[model samples]
Target: MNRRCITGTLGPGLLVLSLASGAVVRAEPVFSPAATDSCVSAAYASSPGLSGHGVLDCIGRAAAACMMTPDGDTTVGMMVCLDGELGYWNARLTAAFAERLADAEAQDAELRTLGSAAASIEESLRAMQQAWLSFRDASCLYEQAQWMGGTGGGPATLACHLHETARQALKLEGWWAQ
Candidate 1:
């Protein structure tokens, strides 16, 4: 088996590759933020109650589609595609957090009426969200560090951000729903 990697500047921040079969493959611009958002939204809309796999499965669909495009195969293109998904997840996370926080506050108030001595749900949620932010930042930085200053670092970090944000969004949504 023979494998070869072709490197040439098609444009700024673009990378091209060639196969061992003398076939050349180029990346095109296929990443669309609207498309990504639509895919994510559809995933959520179609998901059966409490089933998260549907949304999770949609995470990299747009990025994979982008990578297959003629102008979107480069590292920078991948980062941009990942960022689009990250933006979607970040929005979801924000909405979910707000809803969850409100629910927690209500639940805490109910507990107070019952004269229960349990910890405040709203306060606990705030603390947990703060801790999760630190964890997500540290974990993503660690993922980038694994690339050791290589061009892959940027995409890896963005992917990490996407994953963490999506997970947090789902977690918050679940908490609110339950």
Candidate 2:
């Protein structure tokens, strides 16, 4: 894996997310039109009938691809390549998006279940978000600890984390649109 590519791509994403979450407490980062344009282009480029769900799927696939490591031989490499740490990220995001979409589409009798379902789904999403936040912070800390004396591993780790984070953010954006 090219460490520089990972660092460059991931740093901005982390910074953007931090700014969006108010975690930065200072200057807010602006998302360029290119970001939305790429998402829109990807959403409609292949399938015209694509809905918000389709966009979510695209985002998930993209996230999975970014999370994958080229080497899967060693333990750490295997974990990264398998994205074992990201399973919860994928599950929670998928469930949250699915429940929201379903609630939006529900009508009448089915609508009765909407409130309860949405509540449950919202709770799950919230918990998932919290867990993901913890994971992100811990991962960053671990990377820093490992690379405190050098710059070798920090960039790669940060890049991987950022890629997954951005992937999730893109999926969430699509869900919000719906």
Candidate 3:
């Protein structure tokens, strides 16, 4: 067939066929393990160090998996980031509490009671973190309604809320530490 005849004959029908194929093309993976490892290592290397703990490894793996998922869904990515941050924080707090508990053995009975109280505080802090995450997601949805023109406000607002939530959670963590 001539070029124009072939092109004209195959145009709309071909488009319909392609649309009906029920196939979805996916983008490339957004996260790399080497990159994640380097980033996490540099991020936590100095302050509030991990000290060869397996929990840090778990957090890193979860983060990398979340980032690498092929869905390209920003909400899922945000949720993953929040989860990874909480996991890391929880692990760190638990490790710190364990260290303190180990050192408190030689103290008086009141000091032992204080150690138990500290454990309860840690549990409370974790629960508060979870509640803050729920609130953050809901508030972000409410705030982004004003800027819903696909101007990237939804993800930005969500990220901002996550930062604020993390800040508040960390503050609570500081209290728990004492």
Q: Give the whole-model CA lDDT for all candidates, comma-separated.
A: 0.79, 0.47, 0.47
lDDT of 2 by residue, 1-178 (tens): 3222111123321322233223332121222223333664677676554344455443334333433423333333333433433453455456656765565455333645555443444455567777877887787677767866564464446445644664565556353344
Clashing pairs in 2: none
Best candidate per TM-score, number? 1
lDDT of 2: 0.47
Give the alpha carbon lDDT tens digit for every residue of 75-135 in model 3. 5454444455454545555564455444444343455656654444445445765787788
Candidate 2 off by > 4 Å: 1-36, 47-119, 151-158, 173-178
List all candidate RMSDs to the true structure: 7.2, 13.9, 10.6
Candidate 3 clash pair list: none
| lDDT string, candidate 1, 74-151, tens digits | 777777778777887888899999998999999999999999999999999999999999999999999999999999
Please list the residue runs of candidate 1 whose C-alpha ends up more than 4 Å from where it truly belongs after superposition: 1-30, 33-47, 52-54, 175-178
- For residue 12, model 1's alpha carbon misses the true position, in angstroms, by 15
Compute each candidate's TM-score over C-alphas: 0.72, 0.36, 0.36
